[model samples]
Structure formats: structure tokens, C-alpha cells
Target: MPPAPDDRPGPSRNLAVDFCGVSRSYGRVRAVAGLDLRIAEGEVVALLGPNGAGKSTTLDMVLGLTDPDTGTARVLGTTPADAVRHGRVGAVLQTGELLPHVTVGELVELVAALHDRPLGVDDALRTAGIGDLRSRRTTALSGGQVQRVRFAVALVGDPVLLVLDEPTASLDVASRAALWETIRGQAQAGRTILFATHHLEEADTYADRIVLLARGQVVADGPVTELTGATRGRTLRATVPGADLDRLSALPGVRTAEARGEAVVLHCTDSDRALRALLSTGPSARDIEVTGADLTDAFLALTADPPR
Candidate 1:
């Protein structure tokens, strides 16, 4: 028999999720390779990686859908399955079939009933921005609306930790913003949020920390600004009519140059020197903008395959 929740030996009470030397495999494929990660309570962490980087496998272990082949994965000071059974962890997965012939409210209510201590079904619907769609049948929902229903189901459990895999997969721009706002509120209320997304901008704007994975291993982990700052140099953009791409690429401090319509973009180690050179050499340059490397730039740099 498994130990009781309080009796389980945990590393810390403040950690919401803990994976120590955790690994999982499928036949010959190593899905997760000795991962060690810890997320504290009230943290909003974004898990980022290219496809086949073991992101889904890592999340699966956290949700107790699969066990690690070696080592341990704990949630809320207990086993993942134990935490989930006690309504302490909730998840919104990328795919799950909703029950047919049920209204949105009915579906949420049904999920709430499964938890030992769940939030009100109406509250969950409102938080997910689907209160107005409560009377609508699950079969009638659009892709984005269906995503919100999944969110409502997760929220209804009132879990201490929330795991979202592609949470905004089918959302429109406005719906995406709205859902993030709700997630922000959840974080402010002290719930730990761990999400995986391909949208770098979402991770940049929302996550307190980012864990980037590649080849079934963590390639980078840090705050958005810290990781992005590690990527050398700035990016310069300007309208330079009839620009010579090769000339810009050859300029001192400019690492690379590309043309976008009438504009020229320069990846620069020294934006001040590059901008001055651009204006002096190409007098047609205008509308200049210099910005530091963003999350996308950092992601590309960190996850890129090594050249042969």
C-alpha cells in the first residue's frame, strides 16, 4: 500500500512540482532523459521545446498519466497520482474528447463532482470566460469554445497546481488574451501554473521562468529577460530602399542581415555602431528601430542543432 499524503517523504513543502533524476522510455526511444526540475508554489512556469523534445512526456509524468522509468516525480508533497486524487492538481491537455449530448454547464458540473473539494461549477465557467455558453451542448462548441470547456473542467477542481498543455491551441487573439488574464489571476491567488506552448511571445509575456528542452533534455532554464539577455547583441530594423544585403552583412558588429520588403534587419553585436554605419553608407535608411533580443531569438539560439 502507498503511504498517506502527509507521510510521504518530500523534499520541501514549498515546491509544487518536483522531478529528481526522472527518466522515461518507450521501447528504444528515450522520452525523458534524467530530468531534474522543481517548481515552487505560486510560480508560473512555461515549458518550451521543439516537437519530440520530451515536453509531453514530462508533463505526462507530472499528471500521473505515466510513471517515470527511474527516480521520482512528486506533486504537492506527494505522488502525482495521490495529489491528483486529492484534487490538488489539475490539468488542461491538448486533446480530450468531451461527452456528447451534454451542455457546457453539465460537463463542468460532472467534473466538479469527481473532486473531493471543487470550486462551484458556475465559478469555473465564469473564470474560463464561458459562462454565456453554459447552456450550449458540447457537440455545438467551436474549437476555441471547446478549449474553454476543457479549461473550465480543470478550474472546477480548484487544484493547487495547474498544468496546461497548449492551453490556447485554438483560441482567437482576443480569447487568448482573456484566457491569459484568467491564468494571471490564478497565479496571483497562489496557485502554481506549469504550461507548455509553442508561442514564444506568450512565454515571454506571461511566464515567471522558462525551461527550454531539446533532445529529451533541458537546454536552457531561467527568467525570460535573463535567458534572452544571454543571447548576444541587439536587432536593428530600418527602411533602407534598394538596400545591399551583402554590404549590411559585412558591416562591423553586424552578425547577419536580411531583407524584408523595403526594410533591412540586422542582427548586431553593437547596434550603435551598426546604426551609424547604416545611415552613413546607406543614406536612404529611415524609421530605424533597435531592440534587444527577444524570447524567440533566445529560443532559436538555444535549441538550434549543432552544425556538422
Candidate 2:
């Protein structure tokens, strides 16, 4: 059966994809239930979760590859699967099932031909960061190279909403960073993007917003800041030889005190207050390095069991 229609009601007036109380099951297994989400036009959102957390299921529903048992998934004002049939959506699944017999250039041309209107081969190659790989046969390319080719294919059609499922799953660190830039560029060009990933730090750094899922449920959803809201503030990591970790933990306004090598990571509720207190402690306090709470720490704190 085809996925649900994309004209479902949404929270935003400009939502590109909106899901309302959506549920999907596999007989005895309830993979996802009552998941409500709204992604606006031109916004890049990351769906983050552990294995079996329903990340792939959600993407499949959005891309029209899987039908939801109940509720609806709307893509750009039409049904998801129908939208794809109309050439309104493009997606790159984790496994890029490109035709092994075709050359990258040939497959690209074929895809571009599907749209009466499409960006040319030269443009598509340039945009996908694989201009040099065009002549290479799909069978000969490295896993990372093939993923780029898949990205090219997904982008060649020029759909309004691009859904990428673990596009960087096979890529090395550098390739992943480059793809992040590519996705960011696309978002800046006014295309809405929804990608699922387990790279916690990458999601924090690159996503305009993040949706946290676990055990096939929408445990949390919002901008990185929204989930990381309460964890905001300054941090002080100091390497002090004379200090007692227990004594430092007792200091006022110290959110957390952990030993990092010989240094103590002291996250502060207020930098000014913490800095003043540190200075009064000793001359070695000058070694205290003040920093901000980054997304990594925020992610850990939010997903941590103690938070909720």
C-alpha cells in the first residue's frame, strides 16, 4: 500500500512535511505511535535516535516507501507516495541501490530526463561534489563515492523536499563534513531537508533543529537549543594540582565538577560568579579556561536519564 497523503493538517502555515499522531505497526510490534512533527519550508531538521528508534520508519513514511497503519504523513501539500510519483520529493536511502550496469553519467542523464525540467549534467555533477566521478562506472566506485553518486541522483530531479537517510553512513569523517556543507547549501537555496543520523555531534552542529527518538517513540523534538535549553551557560575547565575534586564540587554555582585528565571540568551556572570564586581560591585559578556549553554536552544532558 502507498504511504498517506501529504495534505494533512500541520502546525505551521509553511510546513513542508507534517505528521499528526502518526502510528505504524508490524502486527505485534508497535514501531511508532502518535508521532507529531512539523517541518517548515527551507528548514533543515535532523531526526536523531538509536537503533530501532523508528528513525528509518519515519523517513520511509515521509518518502512514501512505507504506509503508516494509522494517521497521516503529508509532503508538500500532497500524499507522500503520490508526491514522489509527481516528482515533488527526492530521497537517498541508506543503501543506494543504483543500477550496477550503468555508468554514473548514464544514470544521471536518465534521472534528469524524468523531469521535463532539470539541471544539466555539468551542474548536477558540480553541485554534488562528484564532477570527476561522472565517467566512472557504478560498480568500480568506492562506497563513499557511490553514496555521492546516489546524492547526485536524488538531487538531479530537483524536488522541493529532500529526504536523506544516513547519506553519510558509509563516508569517512571528511566526506561527511563535506556532505554537511552540501546539505547546508541546499537548505540555503530554499530546499527543505530531513535526514536521520546517529552522529550526535554532527546533528548538533549541522541541524537547524533536532528530533530525538528512542525505543520507537518521539522522546523529544525541537531545535537543539529547545532540548538543550536548561543546560545553557558557561563552563570552566581548569588543571589544578593542589585542588581537591570534592572541595571544588562543593563550590557555589558549580553545575558539575568532573576530572578530565589532571584538569577539573567545572560547568558554571554563571561565568562571572564562577570566575570570581575561582580567582579567590588561588593564583592557579588563572589557568581556568572559560568556555561555553556546546551541543555535545547539551545532547548528553538532554538524553540522560536524569533529565526527565
lDDT of 2 by residue, 85-173 (tens): 87778888976478988889999999999875677877887888999988888899887788888888888888888999988996899
lDDT of 1 at 305: 88
lDDT of all predictions: 0.88, 0.79
- Residue 298 in model 2: lDDT: 67
- Residue 56 of model 1 has an lDDT of 87
Candidates' TM-scores?
A: 0.88, 0.81
The true-structure Cα RMSD of candidate 2 reads: 5.5
TM-score leader:
1
Candidate 2 regions exceeding 4 Å error are: 1-12, 26-30, 113-118, 200-205, 219-222, 225-227, 267-286, 306-308
Model 2: which ten-residue window has the lowest total lDDT?
1-10
